[model samples]
Target: MSAAGPSLIEFVAKRPWLKKALTPLASWYGNAAGYRQLGLRADDLIPEDNERNLQALSRLPPKEAYDRIYRIRRATQLSLQQKILPRNEWTKPEEDTPYLSPIIERLAAEEKERDQLDTLGVLKKH
Candidate 1:
């Protein structure tokens, strides 16, 4: 999930044919991953132990933050009960979009830019 790693998504996305062919398989895999079954969005499963994820979580709107917490708590209760959410409560595909990823990417880009600036040396032409 780290931006530093090589991404199959990036590779596939570069080629239209590959992306088109894999779209359905990717959808199937997401469903197979089972997070949506518990009423949690895909972003909800992202590990929040990292600095970037923490920052992203902090940036979420108040309502979104509350919803995320509620979802996690509900999912935990369901897990203990050994039950999935009802069909109507499962996160739909359209609702499973990355809510935190954009923020994380923005933070990562800012961090990268800051690091670059920190190392920048001004060469004075005599």
Candidate 2:
């Protein structure tokens, strides 16, 4: 599972050739998505309204959470001003890492586990 439902990340990773082929395109898409231009990481684009995302946001380390908020507020300010960060100030490829996603994935896994446990029922025979 990913932030966007079922993920093929593991499957793609297991295929070296396919992963290699896709890596550049993925990078290109990430850059083209435009969040980085606003000095925001990929994770900053995730909506904060959902349960899993809210849980993930809460679980982030204090400094990391603070940084995330700063980035978002800055981006919002930039957006309202109809401006983007200067080229050098744009989020670099290496800096656009998945800070929130791993936590979200973990939360999703925990929810799945809890649901599985809650569904347990004793057998009854008539």
Candidate 3:
């Protein structure tokens, strides 16, 4: 956005554990944005923790940023299949997963299902 996009160090200072959780997303975003420099250094993002998530957002390429979004999309699907998240949330997948496509279609059996009503409504044991 700016000459200096986002400071990774500043970002991780508040949100620790982000690096570990979002490594896949960060790396992919960096790559997709066509960013030349990942700028990923353990010390850059985290001063005290010394383990910031990744690198310089500003130096990164646009392609890398895009890739990052895609990764997050994929991660979202995996979360659904694990049942950590629900399928209804995926009005459209962030990215498709091999496992979820067929099952998502089955939801089309009824309009209500396709409409993606609240889980309590769908699963309530009348």
Candidate 4:
């Protein structure tokens, strides 16, 4: 929800016709993004240094956290070597789900709620 820029996804998603027409385009764009070739999921491409993402990463289940770290390190090493993973090692589309996005969205919502509560005004009348 807290994207760095305006998202056309939400708009398109709300319209069934638009979503139907754009599904293939979106899939193609995801493939073209090239992270899958590096064996990384879309969530793995999110900047980990940011506060929200860091919190989300911390909240991940242990196995998920380990997998995320493994993928990131693998990607880093591959980038350094200027080599893509062998075809068999590439991330399959089904495996490229946004595992961390929901947690990040929850964290953002919690932060917003906390802000609201912290700023609440108290009124007393007798």
The local lDDT score (0 to 100) that residue 80 gets in candidate 4 is: 97
Error of 4 at 28 (Å): 0.9
Residues 4-28, model 1: lDDT tens digits: 5766877887899999999999999
Candidate 3 segments whose C-alpha is farther than 4 A from its true place: 1-55, 83-126
The parts of candidate 1 lying over 4 Å away from their true place are 1-4
Work out the TM-score per prediction: 0.93, 0.88, 0.22, 0.90
Candidate 3 lDDT over residue span 18-121, tens digit each: 86787688667644542122222221222222111222332335785465455455555665565333434432223222332222224324435546654546
Cα lDDT listed for each candidate: 0.91, 0.91, 0.40, 0.89
- Cα displacement (Å) at residue 67, model 1: 0.9
Task: Compute the lDDT of residue 9 as modeled in candidate 4.
Answer: 74
Q: Which candidate is the best by TM-score?
A: 1
Question: Can you write out model 4's per-residue Cα lDDT over 17-126, one digit (the tens) per residue?
Answer: 99999889989998899999999999888887788888898899999999988999999999999999998988998988888989988998999999999999999998
Q: Of 2 and 3, which scores higher on lDDT?
A: 2
Question: Which RMSD values do the candidates have, in order?
Answer: 1.5, 2.2, 20.7, 1.6
lDDT of 2 by residue, 1-126 (tens): 565778888999999999999999999998898899999998888998888899899999999999999999999999999999999999999888899888988888898999999998989999
The alpha-carbon deviation from the true structure for residue 49 of candidate 1, after best TM-score superposition, in angstroms, is 0.9
Which run of 10 residues does model 3 get worst, by summed lDDT? 43-52
Candidate 2 lDDT at 102 equals: 89
Q: Rank order by TM-score, top first?
A: 1, 4, 2, 3
Candidate 1 similarity to native, TM-score? 0.93
Q: How far is candidate 4 from the true structure (C-alpha RMSD, Å)?
A: 1.6
